[model samples]
Target chain A: MTERDFLCLTPFLIIAIAPVMIMVVVSVLRNYKVVYGFSVLSLLAAFGSIFFVLPSIPHTIEPLLILDVYSMFFLGIIIISALLVTFLSYDYIKQLEGVREEYFIIIFTSTLGASLLAVANHFVIFFLGIETLSISLYILIAFQRSKSNSIEAGIKYLILASVSSAFLLFGMALIYTAIGSMQFGDIVAALTGHDPLSLLVRSGFGMMMVGVGFKLALVPFHMWTPDVYQGAPAPVSAFIATVSKGAVMAILIRFFFIIKGFNNHYLFIVVSGISILSMFLGNILALRQKNIKRLLGYSSIANMGYLIIILLTGSNKGIQASIFYLIAYFFTTIGAFGVIALLSTNEYEAEKIEDFKGLFWKRPFIALVFTLSLLSLAGIPVTAGFIAKFYVILEGMKAGLIVLIISMIINSVIGLYYYLRIITMLFSTPSEIKLPKLSITGNITIAIVGISILVLGIYPGWLIDLIIRFVSL
Target chain B: MNVFFYIAAVVAIISTIMAISGRNAIHSLLYLILSLLAISVIFYLLSAPFIAALEVIIYAGAIMVLFIFVTMMLNIGLERETEKKWLKPCMWIVPSLLAAVLLVNLILALKNVKSIQPDEEAILPKQVGISLFSTYLLGVEIAAILLMAGVIGAYHLGSQKKKVKHRFLEIN
Candidate 1:
């Protein structure tokens, strides 16, 4: 490998070393604060290294990874989201029953997996990266092993995720056998030539989508989403919602952008069908939910529906909008869940909607922050979610996906009722329960997420312009 | 040669079925080991001595032993009272059907594709090493990372927690 290759690969090395650094810090000093600080420091350094290669990229480490604008952008998001999760999880994990220090190691390892997902060029690396992410999450989700729900969530995710990954592997082997190639570029070339992957390739693609769909928690593959969401710790749930789903979506876009045109006719139809089903079922099912985490779970499914529809548009505008929306999604979802993390303690998780009652009266600042986040999620005006959804609609309209645009609007509207219900619950008359005080790190995390959401929402043109310039479409 | 290959394949498949269908976990593990041994023999016949040895050492030796110990620790087999419930005919039907479908699909897929015959001269260990390290280096790194994750996960999950004293006790 050339010096240029090494330089381009520095960002991955930075993230990969974080788990080891954290282990060292934990060994030397058992303090959670120190370990957390080191973890955040490593992530920030990794995010910063992206700028080093940004100007010169689309550099490929042949057959394994690609370094480019699209990858760097997602890597930045993954690092930032992971940083935010680290801060938000501080207070919650500090009070967790079992060993708390090793949790950061798992988080960092998952971040490593996620960043790999952002750039993986080979199926083997893709599978390894995904499994690394999944294995780390299995432990993190069940870190609070005293709680039966946490353990159950971990086990459920383990079984279902393993099963899905097996499907993915089977598909990968089939594709590898059919096309005699393991690289995404080779597959794309074969696909673009004419008839791509015979019947076997077709089946392989179909199976791979099932695995990807499961990771994204789209409809039919969504049975594990709510249970895992409600059962795991709040910050862990946020990690799943944002990092895991975001990384997978980035890879999905990268893979699909190559196989574009009418060549992916069956794929487009199937993904569009899943998106529509996810939107309708996701919103409709969340209507009566009292549990806040489960509510977000279903809403996340609907959000996936919206995010995925952008990819099907098959244009640069579609990629740009999806990236912009994913950035907005990370900010808003992490903010909402951070608030939940702050309010919860070891005794109870504060999952039910009633737990949020009279929040404004008891803790007005926290309540307001949560309300803003929920408004963004519901696609209300003046939030990043609105701008994100607006761009999605624009792209959908450009593609003349009139039915999908209308359905998305309807689902977002349906989604608003539940988000507002929680908002109303927050503003209700003061209840007897005392709202937990927020820790400084928690406050910092929410503040960063909150301000970004507001800034991105109001002046989205800046990001949109930046995205149009740098999105590598 | 063909007769021996058929015998080994049939034995592997049957033992696998017996492994899964057994009422006792220990018996299942023993059957599983037998299946692995047969699979290793098939691999040897295929002329991949390295992989054949790996199959025996890793799969038959380590993995089965791990499974057996875990089953014994969990104390989950040979309960006579639960035997009647466990042996219900309904339990076997679905799995048998799924297995049937999978086996048939495998046969059809195999029939469709041209299978590569093993080389007369076995692939050298050094050649395998050079190809793996040079061409598939990223995969090696990722595998290391995956193993590290598994280690961390296992350590975190298996470590015992120390119980904290209550505030009331501290006050006393």
Candidate 2:
């Protein structure tokens, strides 16, 4: 390895160091507030590191990972989401006992793992990064050990994740048997000559897709999503829905982009089918959901479907669009979950739709932020989701996936009903019960995210140009 | 050499079955260790000696020891075993089907295996070590961190009583 390789991988090294350093610091100090402050500072430093290496494009960390525009962009998203979640977690985890410090450790470790996923170019790093993320997530989900639902969610995630890992490993074994190497570039090179329909390689790819699909919560493999989301602490849910999914999706895009020309029509069709199901089923089922977290869970599956439309396109524009959408979705989803986390107290999680009734009267600013986030998620005009959906549709049109584009439009319309329902509840008569006051940190997080959403919606040209430039470069 | 492979494979399958099906946690853990050892031998046969060694040391020796310790600590002794209606059948059926399919595929795939054309420079251990230390050094270090995290996690979870005692003393 050269000095250049080390330099390229510096961001990852920095992220890895932050959590361990914080962990060691916590051991000595053992102050919750100090630990939390350190966690936020470390995450902010890690976030800053992304931009430091952004200007230098297309650098490979040879044989294992790469630092490039795609990676930097995703790292930007991951770090931003992590920072937001960490800020939100400050108030959210304060209500809990004995585990607040450890929560920061897990959060940082998981963020480090997710960032690794964004840059991984080899299966081993990919697997390691994903497992790190998963193991941390399992613990995070069940961090409230006294809550049976939380423990159940952890067990469910573990079982499903272990099964998916097995499938992924078996797929890797088959792919290695077929192509003799696990590196992305080498696999692409081998695939260019071989028939895409070769049983070994096809099945391997199929199984690998299943594994990724489970992580991304694309339909058929998404059964654990709602239960896990509802059961997990709200901030952790936000992290999973945004940063974790974003990192995995970024890696999937990189992998698929290399093998773009491989005409795996069957896989394409399967992906398309899943996308259609996820869009329609997710939106329709979310309509009946009373639990807010589960509703977001369903909506997330639908959003995943929308993102997959770009993958189906197989163009540079498609990749650009997906990246842009991911940024938009990350902000909106994390911001929305931040609001939920803010409202939650020690005994109650504020999960039911009724719990949010008349929130606008009590907390207009938070209500407005939540409304804007919901509007964006619903693809209303002048929100980030609108621009994201428009870009995706345009990319789909470019790929001539008119059917998928139509399905996305239809699903977005259906999706608006539930998102708007939440908005309407905010305006209902104030409940007699006193509502929680928003923390300064929570308000700042929501405001920042809300402003970004509006800004991205109104002027997406710069972001689109950035995405295109990065994807092409 | 092929005969040895067959025997090793059989032992691995049997041990894996025993690991999952054994009622006693310790017995299952022991079988698990045996299966891991067999897998290491298979890895050795496949010329991945480093991985084989790591498998034995890290997985069979360390992780399994931790697992057994946890089992003991949890005090899941030989108690009244609830009848899992599907588990017994699943234990017999799933492994058999998986093994049969894998064995058949292996045989079929081996039929088309081209004769070995060894590269003169293909020194597996040296190459792997060099690549690991050079190109994949970050991954290796990360793995070490991961193992450290696991150890720390185990200790944190396992030493609850001690932590409580320490806190009590501090409070007093």
Top candidate, metric TM-score: 1
Instruction: DockQ each candidate and list the results.
Output: 0.59, 0.27
What tens digits encode model 1's per-residue C-alpha lDDT throughout A15-80? 778788778777777887788788878878888888987777998888788888888899999988
Docking class of 2: acceptable
| Per-residue lDDT of A332 in model 2 | 94
lDDT of each: 0.85, 0.82
- Model 1 stretches with alpha carbons more than 4 Å out: B1-17, B34-49, B72-122, B163-172
Q: Report the C-alpha displacement of residue A162, candidate 1, in angstroms.
A: 0.5
Candidate 2 clashing pairs?
none
Over B51-146, each residue of candidate 2 has an lDDT whose tens digit, in order, gives 878898999899999997787667545333423532466545644554454455345434533322132222377888888888788789777656
Q: Encode model 2's per-residue lDDT on A299-413: one tens digit a residue.
A: 9999998898777787777888888899999989987898899999878889899998999999888888899999999999999999999888988998899999999998988
Q: Mind sharing the TM-score for model 1?
A: 0.90
